[model samples]
Target: KLRIRTPITTRMTGCPNGCARPYVAEIGLVGNGPNMYQLWLGASANQTRLAWVFQERMNLDDFERTLEPIFIEYKKSKRRAESFGDFCDRAGKEELERVVNEFDPSQSLVKTTAKPRVSVTTETMDRLTRISDIRGLSPSKLANEILEQYIDSLETTVHAQK
Candidate 1:
């Protein structure tokens, strides 16, 4: 097991509807079809940045095996206090792809089975559902868009102040 210095925010959604804010998560997994997912990585821990799609379609059975190279590289090369997402961002897509392509799973030492759990209150869900119905968008998608707009507005205000 790798001892990570910071918490990683991983979000998984059953569909592209993004009820879990997967786009902004450090590790986002969006189900594209039966037993297939779009793997995403590189968002900031604070949810300030959007994650990028690392793999367009990854088999569910290959999840742990596919990430072994990445985890190994992270454990060996990350800077002090750097999170998994930060490391991914620093490495970029090209480097990550190279590593994955050249990795020998037989020599791998990492195996992860950790899963994240999230809870939504009924009241909040009901509100989101109502608003989302009126807006013709998924609740999570609407919420994320609003959050992005709010963050952008804040940045604009800060720039104005300066």
Candidate 2:
């Protein structure tokens, strides 16, 4: 017999920037505020990885009230020892969207605004050039590496404090 384990874990408050690797969990509830949450679902160890943002800015009270029924349905229909991610893959995105819409009716049809591009001035370019020369790398390559490291460090610091 294959024994399955399901545990509900909690993180006080944090952002999902892959620093904490929240997408690896079966059910991840991220705090958006005092009483708001963003629910992440269907993450697993298999390479078939995708975590859908089920709800955004959902009131914690509302989430608690709504989650039980959905979970019950999953439990009832789940295959013998099928993981949450497997179940979600089998269920498909449309069904997941339907489930989420039932909880938060006012689904934002609007797409997220794209981040404004940072124009690289001469001063910025010169600084990047100097760093690249010192590191023996091309300016473009150095810039990319620097940006990646900077973002990772920022996320780590932010999560550490939380």
Each prediction's whole-model lDDT (CA): 0.86, 0.64
lDDT of 1 by residue, 4-118 (tens): 5568889999869888999888899999898899999999888888899999999987888778888888888989989888899999999998988899867866544444434
Question: Which one wins on TM-score?
Answer: 1
Range of the 10 consecutive residues with the lowest summed lDDT in candidate 1: 110-119
Judging by lDDT against the true structure, name the best candidate. Answer: 1
Stretches of candidate 1 off by over 4 Å are 110-162
Clashing residue pairs found in predicted model 1? none
lDDT of 1 at 55: 97
